[model samples]
Target: MDTSAPVRILTVCTGNICRSPVAERLLQAGLDQAVPGGFEVASAGTRAMVGEPMQPISADIVRTFGGSPDHFAARQLTPNILRGVDLVLTMTSGHRGEVLQLDASLLKRTFTIREFARMLDVLDQRAADGVAEAGAAVVPSTADAHDGASPLAANAAYWRGLPARAAGVRHLSLPADSSENDIVDPYRRDPGVYRQMEDQLAPAIVSILRHARLNAPSAEAAAGPGS
Candidate 1:
């Protein structure tokens, strides 16, 4: 059997009631099914409504995606919150700036969610294009060898190394418009904006979950300790 600490992920937005919470709940739900006990996801805002529940529209989106919106309260981002997180997904590049401002050490681990998704897509594409045997080849690390390891161990190593691997291929996939990398906030906005929020955020979430489920090693790889 493989035993390792769960990977921690944090999502960020402005008010915390909108984008980040939806991302947090949906990611947590999907990862529960995808990797099960392998990840933890949470959210906070830079200027959080700090105790407010998720906005109704955003809550709807979460439910639509098979996630829960009950019992959520907004929180402000802090260095303490950033501690021990393996990945940080922000709603906008500006939010990304704020996160890095709080903790520069997370520079490699933090990314605009859309940008991160695209980077992962690029890496996934590279593996398909046969540019590398595996996307991990882009970073050339001696770590993360999957041979005879439990599926959980393999999954952990692959994902822990993912930020660097994704970062390596990012330049190849820049959006034509920089704003394309951000999910528009829908706090107190009209229906169109809510649609825009879902339009932008859902695909990124889908892409992330897709990558996780696809890349997670199969059960056959769980060779157990001392195999």
Candidate 2:
């Protein structure tokens, strides 16, 4: 798969108004900052609240994270939407299963948002090592390859290979504890529940953006000292 074309990513949840939209916007915002025209992000519900705006609290949270919730409306998930998407991120394990049921080939690309996050650091490290090894084999030395482009451009080229690297990541073992892989739905709950959702989601989203070679402000803060 030549990922040189725009990488289309879809986020799925039970209702489009809550988790999926939040993930959609955050991923978009991060990708916009990272690789301006390189990616596209969208969201849909397995069981939609069609034509509805994002839940007020969800919209508020989106704004808090520097995403505009303006003019947003819910849409139901469909096979057409999944047809060309490069990635599918779901809020829970069940949602991941639902997406896979719709299209089994998506199994290599679809993952619970939390599960993907947990696996990302290892995947990224593996990719970096692979890139370095390949570069060494072909170019002889990193110093010699610097003659053609600016460092930033070279860095971008390296990260652009991530989608392909992701195939290997998909085959790696996932953590055994399933509960750690889910993001509980907080719909109809109090503000505290929403906050809890944010706490869980914020880090996972950051990890994802990082794996995609995107900059995420929240992820940076979360990584403060050791990171």
Candidate 3:
């Protein structure tokens, strides 16, 4: 519930070698730059991609786009993975269901990546409402309230500062008229196809980051402590 306790976010795909890793790195980069220490990002595959490296072409594409290739590795999805993850961004609707099956409580935290981005839209609106009600002149803290303090209270305080309305759950629906519950898996496909999927994913990733920031209560809390 506390958005600030290093938001544990996981990005998932069929193979960790391509899309999931790419999304993980991009989201990490964005979070590091925009909201340092506020998020912890990781990636995993639905299928066992254990001990594999990123595909050569995937590496090439990541480098071509200026993404960090050093921090990626393949791992399979599991129920325990849902424990601490604040959010789970899967490649498709089926993946979302799979994650939920692993842990039904995740039904609240998991979503197809696009759906998560859409949820961000709602969170932003709620945060805006909080901002409006608190007025335009309040200045609040940007760092975690317990940066150097106790863990339990620090965590509770962060969650408490969040807009109670925005702190509730969110869900996703498959886009209409789309047979593909996911972006077609391009893991073993041609590099061009991977690139095409990349094109689709990149924008959605940015939107997710933007929404996270817009909805980020800590930033607003820093602006108005009691707000």
Best by lDDT: 1
Regions of candidate 3 where Cα sits further than 4 Å from its true position: 1-4, 122-174, 179-181, 215-227
lDDT of 2 at 94: 92
- The digit string of per-residue lDDT tens for model 1 on 156-193 reads 67777889888888888799999999999888888789
Residue 123 of model 1 has an lDDT of 73
Per-residue lDDT tens digits of candidate 2, residues 1-227?
45245668899998898888989998899877775665788999999999999888888889998988888889989888899887788999999899988889887778788877766766657646664322334321212223443333333344444444544555563767777677778888888888887888888888877865532123233233444
Regions more than 4 Å wrong, model 1 = 1-3, 133-148, 224-226
Instruction: Say which candidate scores most in TM-score.
Output: 1
- TM-score for candidate 3, residues paired by index: 0.72
What is candidate 2's CA lDDT for residue 60?
88
Q: Which scores better on lDDT, 2 or 3? A: 2
lDDT (10s digit) by residue, model 3, range 1-227: 44446767898888788788878888888777655676778888889588788777667766766668885679998877667776788988888878887889766666678655654566556556664423222322233442343333333343233322222424333346443335557776887898778777777788767754543435333443454
Q: Candidate 2: TM-score?
A: 0.76
